[model samples]
Target: MINKKNILLAAVIFPAVMAFGQQYGGMWIPTELNEKEMKAMGMKISAKQIFDPAKPSIKDAVVQFDGGCTAEIISPKGLLLTNHHCGYDNIQSHSTVENDLLANGFWAKNMGEELPNPGVTVDFVLDIKDVTGQILGNTKNLDAKQAEQVIKNNIDVVSKSFKTEPHQKVIIRPMYYGNKYYAYIIETFKDIRMVGAPPSSIGKFGSDTDNWVFPRHTGDFMMFRIYADKNNKPAEYSKDNVPYKPKHFLPVSIKDKKEGDFTFVFGFPGRTTEYLPSIAVEKIRTEIDPAMIDVRDVALKTLDEKMRADQATKIKYASKYASVANYWKKWKGEVEGLTKSDAVGKKQHYEQSLIAKNPEVKTTLDEFNRLYTEQSPYALSRAYYSEVIRNAETLSLANNFYNFANAAESGKMDAKTLENFKNRLTEIYKNYDPELDAKVTAKVLALYANRVQPQFLPSGFEQYKDVNRNLQTIEELSKNSVITGRGTLNGATMYSGIDKVFEDQNSLVQNLKNDPLMKLFTSMRESYLTKTDGKYAEYQKQIDVLQKKYMAQQMETDKNRTFYPDANSTLRVTYGEVKGSNPKDALYYGYQTHLSGVMEKYVPGDYEFDVPKKLIDLYNKKDYGIYKNSTGDVPVNFTATNHTTGGNSGSPALDANGNLIGLNFDRQWEGTMSDINFDPRFSRNIMVDTKYILFIVDKYADAKWLLNEMKIVK
Candidate 1:
């Protein structure tokens, strides 16, 4: 039954084929790089130079920005560079009608003028250690549940017992679906300050229409600085804290780039599911992605109409609309890319080949098929519920109040907790427009009621079937609901009443229970918790166990093929050549975009494409200075083959010698499916060329003092 000879032959041939097909993709753990392959692909530096835990290296310059995106320290003074979108929330938090940073942009004339962000942080990975043997050694003979507990216990012991500085912490992450584990010793600096940002017209030039598309000219970089205590260690924000001096900083490169130059992205990349079974991929492509996209489609349409009608509404909903549109557009592209690349068919063929060679994996593959088939409905229901609650601000607020009420009932709501809740509510209402939110809630609820199956629909959601009635009901309910702060507690008085409501926990709980919005939230959440969440989680747990087994088996069976763990918000290195592609038939794209393209797309007074007057003046005057390429144009953005994903935003796209050449921001529209199925022919990570960043700073913004700090590599 086991064809050992065939398996041996298959491993040798299949690896070569797979390598060629995958082509310049793989988010490699810095500790374990394919050094030979990297060098062969034209890396001038050694792997040790890339990630030496004992000394300063490229890894020292990279940080996990604000816990989600990546940013690199570009100067010895901890001048951090990241994408505008990555720093969007922090930027918006400081903006107002009088000082709209998002619209006009902000640049500090001196360090004293730098704006401090209270809670933002940058985490540096001090060291990474492999503790897979320690984690798995004791679990071999245990039951699944017992093994999980043992793993959790081991993780706690490993993390807590690990030697670290007072401010440093250790976090262990499972890789290859728990086949391995790595503990990261991280130093988190909390005193991050915004130094500069370009206006939205430059930072988010093409907006939604050009978000994931290539041949883009968006100058999407933002600047921030890290501050630390006297000893240059992590500390809480204080005015006296000095600028952090980093161990290493990337030298910004303004050198011209060629099509075949070697490039590598070094930073934290978010989640990716490269190893999912064919059935799972298919479900995501067809059922799950489509369902989520449809819900957001409705929400975006409603937000867009209201935003265009009023400037204040636009300012209020800018971040919310962008966040929703991002994944919505990405999912649409993912589906198209999946279909265009024949991802499911390719995965099926690969599975067939694997099973044919190693027959033992057939059982695992069969199990995957069965589990996925059974899990489809639960997955779709979960997706719909998540989208509905996420888009509808009123429902989200209601859910928050319900949780607060429950916490109060459980005696968990202390004075500090109540204060925090009040602050959070204030922040929420700061940008909230009830009229806009009610419209969105009505639309998304109707979609949810219509699309979800009867059995999966939440009880009382039948009332949402009529959109007009739902809108009217929501409007009327909002007038008196404490959660909405309308009617009796209108405007400033409403905010003051927040404290009064909390004074009597019993009355507050009763009021929350009776609130119509809370009732709706309770219905939806309870249905999910009762009917869908548990079953979906259980199925996922089983699938995960099987997947771990599947991973080990595949590795054992195909010894020649190299495997990289999927991205899980960990520091990684992905290398490739600077190149472009014909993502579709009869349409070829170049590797780079120029500033000229920005002007070409510019429309006067347009929201998305309008160019700043200073930038236009510089372009007309041909004042490119040192940032201009040999071809007499400033490089705006470029594309490369490095495999990246969501959290890779603001990652440093480095040259072969480890200089920061560009800021990794977005991906080509057809390549957004790289997270699930990376087709090298189409997958490209877009980056704002460092030259463009410099040009904008020196010429457009006149922030030469900031540039003076950076090590500019010619």
Candidate 2:
């Protein structure tokens, strides 16, 4: 049940908050507990009900074969379902034009057709225990610092006790900040393999352009299977490895369901920020988002220019370009939201109003704003330097860790791991675009040098220069690529290493503590007053006073309303009717699209949204097969406005009654801002019409057994 008032506050009040309406909860109903609501609309069972090991619907039928994304046991013999891009690296590693599994969808007519993916594994969540008692069981009145450490210690102790063996993995995550903690005991299977994936042409048709946007026509989905040893335990792959057994696969029904059908999504949704000071909001809008947009735009433009001039360069940069361009588009959207929306003014007003109500909160508001104002610019500069220009610094640090580890610790690297790391270096360095990397690195550092403080510098780099525009001189210093590139790539090892990182000798860290360049970067970041310990203290005080007031008034004004805490990556439920919205009277994003619209995106030469020949051939064959939706052809589109964020990809979108109706792959770009502003009009969940997926499987792949496995109903 939702609190009517809070829902109104989320859906209407607070313009910025309402704008990002769908980012609040998750993709689907997790348990059969949600089944009653699901059935009212002619659906089956909640994803939670289907996948929860404790639930009855598919409890025994579901298996948690670990993958980056979740997978479900869908067959009497273990079969798994997951997204294709999650398996991209593995599939790409084994593919060539002749047998490009990505370009042409892989179909295993039988278990023998499945291919092995080394180092890939599936994890099954075996047990989850709510340990709120164990954590807050004592010391309810401890100071924040003491509480933090105590929580850590308590979690460690409980985690150790819960572990059945060394092979199982243990995780204890706190929920609602300090309110609760959950321990998840997992059994990880290391030897998982790729069953099949459609070519990017079809599987990822819209590519970046259609990535977060809609009228979005993209297949953006895929499938895989997990394997195990005959003992039904996790195992490494070998010629002898065989198909995993016993689990439930989703059943399909082509029965026509009309618009406004109830829908939901269930998958491991990663993270969100429904709780933040409007102060943070203003800062993000004013300084952070814009600066990032500009920096990424510059790099992407440079890369695109070079890639366009040379075919070989383009191929080499396909992945890089795709990544850069995709995010650049996102940032640009963010920038637009910042400028066009009332994020800044609204945040300011909200903070001010909060402070006005409680004199006790004035100090906290003042301190927060004081720090936020100071740090905003500096924080923005460091972000550009760290993320865009000095991007190599991260890899440098990683390499340094490896180096220090092997150098300081004896027997740190096994032969295979060492070989693997060496191979990684060889590959990275060989194709590494030194010129582009250096150019970006130099500019970023220049920004830091000019904008930040020298006091922050390490004594070494500091003695040579002051924090000023003179950082351009460092670019000249970079001319010795033999010097800069070598130092950044190889010399980083002197400071970084696996064993060394874990070791307590902060000697290298201290030595570089005064490194002028690093200090300069640090100084730039120090500008943000938001992180000041004193400021946070004051802010906490004010919040304490204000929360007491706000809570009382909120209770009186919105009586009998359900108000859950902001999403803490814990389980939660949100309910809404399925309806399309008119963002503006003149424009409306219909909650559905068809296969023919996908065909319309086809162009002969462009790679971005080009349709694959085989899929086109399959479509032209006029064979709807099992993939046809109510319209009698593959259904390619559906919609939902459930709140979602980064981690929600691949969640199963269930209709009312908890039946699997669609797979949530993306949010419409118009709604990409859904994270910050969910305009139900444009913010809708993008799903790969289940019927279309079934068509790809049955008509295209001919996996009749897969169809037989699930209890499909309409």
Candidate 3:
């Protein structure tokens, strides 16, 4: 609930033109774009051309890829383009030792050869509407809990009452800390199929070493196609389904790009916390990021060693390693970037000015500082629990068993629930290695025991303080635990006869309860549930309330300041220019990289820098075809000033004329902190030049059928 003081401060933040002097940055909603400013920055298309619900527009082509990343339609036949990593899981699912699609890429010669993905979906934004007033209309006097329920009820009613087709879903998301709300009418197509993907040597080139670094030569793009029913609407995957006909698809542009050429990213950018107070930012930089990084560092080291030694292990853990390493490295860079950029100092200075302008803001800032100080330890404990349980795969599996056992005891385990559990267990064991997990668990648990405060440590975890003894205990558990199914201990294993074991719920629950790994997981889970979680949630709610008020206060205090809601996984338009950066003193990065750079970094038989033989041959022969740029070298990757974050992966980077020129992938290491503190000096989004994608399909893979479908503009 909001008080009278805050209520008075709360006004409609969404004006037609919110920004004034700032030329770049901001993830603007499609409906409220700054047309004049975009034109001034070299945009040749009108706002209507970018997004028109009634007609074909650029927005019609872009979609939310499988809910986590972005993708766009590239042809009239619904050919989709996204990052290789975005499709990594599907590719990995189809790979085996005999035919490793990841090591040697996959290309479909014709439509009939395309591989269907069971659960993949591409969502289109049919329309967006402001639903703030209706959502918050009756909750001014209620407390936080009561108001939350009322808001939820309102959202349910509003969504159900909205006029939409049966295929469309209405999602309402709050912005500016619940100050505003927007409803998105989404049409999700579930029948998506993989068309082509380059090998890891091309798609994931430079892997960990160059993940967030500039001068990156990674191709990082994958191709898929959407399918629809006879009516050309969303449907389940069926043999009768046909390639979808899209209303709009991007025109592939091979025109030469110059520095400062207007570029904009259109995608569903993920979460960002750009409005946190100085105290919060300082805590994250100093305490939170380092703690999580430490946990992942141990897990990645153990996994990387095993992966390099065995090909089977490599295939199993490739996706897992990439997932862990992506954020582990990003956090390292985020800490550095926050420190280098002096984000806390700048935020503190701004806070002082804000308080000076309007003294009433002092209360809100003081509350923030106090809450953060009180909440730091609890927050750290929560982070440790989450990271430790996640990285220790055996313990994670045990936790799942614990949950299932509890459900069985509680009479909630129906046949479908049991079946789902079995399926999940099978999927996990498909990639599970008990010995490898044991090694990782020993190191991570030891770190957790030593680092977490005694008060926050789970009861059984205290024994883990003895590192050698802890290692021995985990070794024994991995060998005999029912969760791992490695060694027989009363004939209870996860592999076979799961249904027979579950026939007697009491016996199953008792067995799981007695398992050593499950006992360890229960101790940790119970301790957190009893000691830390409640307090953490309490402090977070208080912080969220104050933060919302603080946001309004800042807007009211600085009337001239432009405001945009922080990203919450919604379609946004972030425009900038093709530009380079000087991240540090005397350190400059160019806007683009070429095939020559890839060759220079190539190392034969190396995991990260290996180049495919066909690619090398093409490079030696200079066979770049029409995809070669004006410099007579094919561009591999490039950097731009468009503000982006995690979910922007696979977003479309459009040129001035709204042509697809690049596929947004990674961000420069120095810019990973842009989610919290965006400093234009160091923040740049990395992209794959569209020309490189075409070159790989045409010259390297010889998939001319794909190029024939695209509308390539020379």
Candidate 4:
């Protein structure tokens, strides 16, 4: 499907890496580490020191925080350190206008004052074992569908093989395009409590404007404690619980780090696609990312306007806005970075080289290219559907109502089901602003109709033809939507005791189905399911087969070139150096930002740039203590070449001796594309320096009690 000339041309343009060189990329598995390469890169600790179930190792200290981010134990008493943003939701839940912990700061002077969070959890890796043989040993001759079922069954058996503790969990995850599998035995601690956080002025300094950028001065660290039963076993929240005694905890290092200092990050990296084919990369950069970015840009602009105008709205939409803006800016930067780096060309170059050496790989590459070209439209449409429909609060809520109505019509509605759905709805409406949601719904649906292919457009789009007309229709629909207490759903009495809805399921079902908004949402959702469901699934299956073959072929062609599996929300290690970056022809970015930069960016009454008075006074007096660097400056944040991603938010940036020096929080905007295509030159992971963290704890917060608990090394 793709031409040889194009691949060759890209190869000619791409700057290929040397045949055998250490790439500061790849999220390597802990057990399968390249000890020789690590030593060459200045590792002072043995591989076993990084991960050994029988011994106290770094892996014992790192945890998957709330399943989305990473956190590390820095004290034997289970004092947890993570990115401030990682603990943002918990901070938000505890914030009120009067006691705005987010605006101010929170610190627990003692263990008894630590605030308990109900659903927040932390999981530690007990052990990770290779289970590829058991998962795939018997499925050599089966079709993809059959093989999937067999693999799942095998995973279940492998998971059950380990008799785990009460709160422990076992997950078997596929690696290297399902060519390998790793079974992880993990223990989840339910009693996680918030201990301290700097005000957003410090924690979220520069905010959205500086999110994925470098030269950052944000504090960006939070403190929490894991509580367990008296025996140090996992337990639910209780006054009787004690601080967890961990097997290993990182010691804080105040040693000065220079540009070439070796650094490695240990954490659960969320996802990466360093092995993506050129065609797939092209589609993502050119089509899917743009569509999603455009929709979010609109949503963010609308939200920003409202948030800036009202403080209440700012508090209500702060987290939501950040979540949306994060990936929106990321996608924008990804597209730019990919183009700038000629990532697609590089991928093509790699593929071309591989195919030249192994002609047998041609079939897989051909199928991959063909499927990619054919599936481009579907992928774009799917992204739009997600951005415009699935993400829009009103439409998403409407879909829930549609589901509940369908259950009623099908005679499957029960009191319990009704109550469950009601609770879910109430949660949705809790932070929801009807006016803002209405505006977003109108704008996004208009974008959907204008951009997506007409044939694949939602069935409801037939009612309105133009953007202006669609907006009017949406306005009317929102005003009359029964879900918002109008028309069929106008009676508040009906919802007061939602269980009563089960009494007349037939009537309720008919009323809900007849509602104008429900009718529109049902039409759109039903059309999507009918038209795209099986079709996309089939395409995905074929793509998977081709991708797996391609991945295997890549390995076979390069026996000497070590291949590490792409990240799949699993524990991994990526090492590099504390270094600066040359982003463009003339511009260069230094490795670190200092406390002086924080003062320079400060703005009075500014939400993002405001600095606390106490911090200012300390900075003014040069009261940094022993934490100050040799240059007589307090370093706040630094950049490294360590390969990292979303879940590495709170990962510990360790030194050559495996001592914690910094906390990984972000990647450079230009390097965000490292997820798909990592070029070490521009890929720098940002971290909050440990010295600055300690300086804040001691000088600003006067948190000597917390500081005394940590093993600080000067």
Best candidate (score: lDDT): 3
Question: Each candidate: what lDDT?
Answer: 0.88, 0.56, 0.89, 0.85
Worst 10 residues of 4 by lDDT: 15-24
Candidate 4 is scored at a TM of 0.92
Please provide TM-scores, in order, for all candidate models, with all chains considered together: 0.92, 0.77, 0.92, 0.92
The sequence of per-residue lDDT tens digits that candidate 2 reaches over residues 72-144 is: 5555556666666666777788788798767666766666777777777766555567787997687577776
**Candidate 4 local Cα displacement, residue 78, angstroms:** 1.7
lDDT of each residue in 513-557, candidate 3, tens digit only: 788888888888999988899999999999998888898888789
Worst 10 residues of 1 by lDDT: 487-496
Off by over 4 Å in 3: 1-24, 94-99, 238-240, 304-316, 459-461, 492-506
Model 1 misplaced stretches (Cα beyond 4 Å): 1-21, 93-98, 228-232, 235-241, 308-312, 459-463, 468-480, 487-505
Candidate 4 lDDT by residue in tens digits, 305-326: 8998999999788767887998
lDDT of 2: 0.56
Q: Which parts of model 2 are misplaced by more than 4 Å?
A: 1-55, 58-67, 96-98, 161-170, 229-242, 245-248, 335-367, 389-421, 438-479, 483-585, 676-682, 708-711
